[model samples]
Target: MGNSSFFFFVFCFIFLLVLGTCDCLSDQEKDRIDQLPGQPSNVDFEQYSGYVTVNEEAGRALFYWLTESPANRDPKSRPLLLWLNGGPGCSSVAYGAAEEIGPLHINSDGRTLFSNPYSWNKLANLLFLESPAGVGYSYSNTTSDLYTFGDAKTAEDSYAFLVNWFERFPQYKHRDFYISGESYAGHYVPQLSQLIYERNKGVKNPVINFKGFMVGNAVTDDYNDYVGTFEYWWTHGLISDSTYKSLQKTCEGSSSEHPPVECIRALNTAEMEQGRIDPYSIYTRPCSYTTSLKRRGRYPWMRGAYDPCTENYSNQYFNLPEVQKAFHANITKLSYPWQTCSDIVGGYWTDSPLSMLPIYKELIAAGLRVWVFSGDTDSVVPLTATRYSIDALNLSTIANWYPWYDNGKVGGWSQIYDGLTFVTVTGAGHEVPLHRPRQAFILFRSFLENKAMERSSISI
Candidate 1:
């Protein structure tokens, strides 16, 4: 530990300086965090209007969606946005509800909402969905109900979720819809979007009306996300100069080359976990965070890193009996763990299996719009990775690549391709909303207002 003190100090210093004025954590840590004062468990989540089950006759499967009504939402809405949590194994209820965007951002106090006026619900009626069954509140009564955890199965079930979910909320049927997610969603959003486009081509009934999609700091490609991230850490000075140089030489040279890939993967993952934080801010990173927020950058946008699965988020989530009960729900007996990470070999996604590129291409060909945005400082799924993945498509044209300014600083960059656009939300890390809510709100509104997704009528 002493040998690494210099790097650690530098990391701490940077985090403190960047987030010197963080407002989330308290000046008070000892004031008895609001514990769950022992209320009878109301895990009767099945009764809530927000939860709509999908039961197909072919299989006695049970899946659920938490639907927040657009009518109850602010009138500023435009479309019904479906958000899927990634991890290929994680639950959207955990991340989408408790952390990033929902009705609230629970403070350490546990009983309050730092009411996220910036919640995506502020713009579009938000749907936090758990899909492929056996995830979150979704379940399979029969063995066959669980779709094989793969790109194709995920897309099928997700598209099915939309088709059936619309049956319950008929109002949103004809209204425009958008698909979005992060991490493993690189496979989800695109594949599901393709399902919508393909099925809608000849149909008198189209459940997922074509609209734009959004992804942030996503895992869209294997080679790019894994390889490109190391370069980012080195360029940003998070990794030691020697380590970075050594990585470039040893790891950069291999792809199919085994034994060395895991080393490269770890080195790159370090850069992602190290987010922005200010040392002097008094708001510390989580106990298990491999690096400090100060060391990496608590990502100025999200502001802290407590492993989402830990009791640190208990008050934020499990404080409610419904959440607590769900955590212990008999999932593993059904062959899936209530997991935040995969412990099994080959876990879930063995490849950088991204989904949206095909969906984007389908949408572009059909004249629908598509966009992908990232928080510039996020090492989680850095911007270069997105770029390299999209390059796989060999998009034929380019339009604008310019700095997007906020508060007179280069907040990030925005670029337009033939049919898709990518933007970097400057100064932000992963979970763009938690980190840069205002900017994320602005980006979402741009898509809703039909300005950002609209292509110039003039053709070259």
Candidate 2:
């Protein structure tokens, strides 16, 4: 054979060999992360981030980051925990996954990642979703989808994502599953769990071996949230007595989601009185960029190591083309930049309920384990609000409230109700795990074990 012809034949043979080897693994297995941008070397656990198409005709897809349990190599025994973040338009990948509980956090420089020793993935296979098809890298081909989004549709799309996601990773088809989220997720988590519960009813041997759900500082009841928030502000000495009384009088029986003009005026007065402190965590320093707090010559975005002002770094990291390519995200070349919170989605959110207590009651009555936790320092969804909402359930207290300890110190407080458990992480704000990692990890481990938190002072 001629030399050129022989070389062409050899190339063809090698090409087929490479193609065959590449196609050997299942699509799901192929999705296993080889490496993430700026990931630390010598990492042991596998991580996957990509899109799961929930709707084909509409070309709608949701983004997810799945981190395998670092401590447990065996997938069969570990549970799968799905986490969502409540912004009505927030990216769970940005906040919940990258910033709070995920294995790695983007460094302040926005080009590197650091290990979070206290990540929840040590106990469970953590999945962080950027849901509703308009948040983060998730997108919809149908332009109208962005404009018309709400609680019901978000729940529906999320369930579809799960069903399809199971097909992709069948090894986890029957893995014990739990859902957890915070803030507006007070609406998202329970609503999705209700859907899962209802769907799993008639089917024998369901794909998702659903277990229970937990929410932190959730917005369960509008009235209670407002009352509790205003009461908390007053009790914490963040607002004046006159402003507090005005808030109480004007906000009574009012919707926090869409408050009346008088209620808005009262809230305005209270906010003005509270000054530049972060509303999410009263004691913690606010993100200088987001807040008006004065910092001499300190750029708002130039946060230091492990700073809680992570939004800026997260945004910069996700927007990097190399980072996007590493995760196989943003395949469609999204029109907008990556945002921690999506203005498009948040602006269009509709059909918010006045209360999720009824849904909680339904889930509790169905024998599903339910837990609600709060970061005591969070003024936005304070412990008082969660307490008031849980009181509306009127569940008989099985265990009296007591301090739960970790490492010979009081981690927080907890109380067990008949079918629900309530926990408070001391000194933590809206994002419990971010602020109090050890305590949050302890609470998470106890919740997964279905064991009571340690009440007596003892090292974890």
Candidate 3:
């Protein structure tokens, strides 16, 4: 063959080979997902985990894990559910994804994962985020970001993360999206949802496709929360009469985080009276895996999960080098290990509003779906607290309170209102899914469907 003809043939051959290689990989493969260190073999869903830069100037990024529903639903049709854990400093990747609502649970050995049959991913495309640049695998190059975090900054950063994240995937740009969280997320979810709702107005068509939001055992109104909490403690026989009276007298109008000296003393007395009985769950046994409580000069408290041992296991699993590498996390190799909650952020949280009810009202007025749920056994942010906060909204009742069932037994009680809904899981604690996975899943499905909780459903 002539030299020119041979050279052209070789160039064509190289071009075809490169094109074929690109065609072989699907979008899921193109996106980063190194197989989990020890994932279950039978898993059939696609999973992606990585960082999205929310602020390039400050080197702040948020880590996220997205799990497509196992039912093999089309990504276009399935709604997106973004879940945040409270604490204002907690790792949603660790607690929400690994321990509670994600598709898998860490094995007791902390080296393997097992299927979570009642995972929320079965209902939608679930996303778990470690937010605010200091929690879990998310971080900031600027050290001040760790200690100067609060509601406004967290909400803003999370919204920016969403905008950048949609760019990364692109497929889910206009997909129906919902935000949910618990505890301090009572503040996080509502504030972020409000921002999404407002931002949607300025643009012709929002890429976010923002829908509604839900919070479980959330901190809503400070006054109502304090009142309901003190009442719950008294009614549950957790505190003495004098201590309860003292709380009522001293903590009525003061900030719960920084009450007066008399209120602090009363709270201390209440703490002493209640002893080490896991204020979060009230009934579950505390994790015995670590002596860290002794090191901190504090009593260990029960974890919110049904299997209290899972916390320690998850902690161990997340800190593993293989696991971190698989998830593409901890790339900076910081001085400390990955913790479920960040001491830096939690200790230095600067601003918490006296109430999130105003934000909730704005969202509801915008015709957005708002649902608030509570685990009846959670003393920290009990059902009573949620009810009182909702009562402040004065929303009209659409449906009377009724029992919702699963497995032929009452799963929880739910009441529907014109612009909102309230639910209480029968035996759940602060973290509903971790404590009552089956029941939590039922509530989750009904919420997504925009219908009343079913009286009965096939149990997982």
Ranking by lDDT: 2, 3, 1
The TM-score of predicted model 1 comes to: 0.70
Alpha-carbon shift of residue 3 in model 3 (angstroms): 7.2
After TM-score superposition, the amount by which residue 245's alpha carbon in candidate 1 deviates from its true location, in angstroms, is 5.8
**Which residue pairs overlap in candidate 3's backbone?**
286-302
Best by lDDT: 2
Candidate 2 per-residue lDDT, tens place, 159-217, comes to 99999999999889988999999988999999999999999999889999999999998
**Model 1 — which ten-residue stretch has the worst lDDT?**
42-51
- How much lDDT does each candidate structure score? 0.56, 0.84, 0.83
lDDT of 3 by residue, 90-191 (tens): 788878898889998899899999999899888899999998889889999999889888889999999999988888788888889999988888888999
Candidate 3 error regions (>4 Å):
1-31, 202-204, 289-307, 455-460
| Backbone-clash count (model 1) | 21
Clashes in each model (backbone N, CA, C under 3 Å)? 21, 0, 1
* lDDT score for residue 44 of model 2: 74
> Which is the winner by TM-score between candidate 1 and candidate 3?
3
Instruction: Estimate candidate 1's alpha-carbon lDDT, on a 0 to 1 scale.
Output: 0.56
Q: Give the range of the ten consecutive residues with the poorest summed lDDT in model 3.
A: 296-305
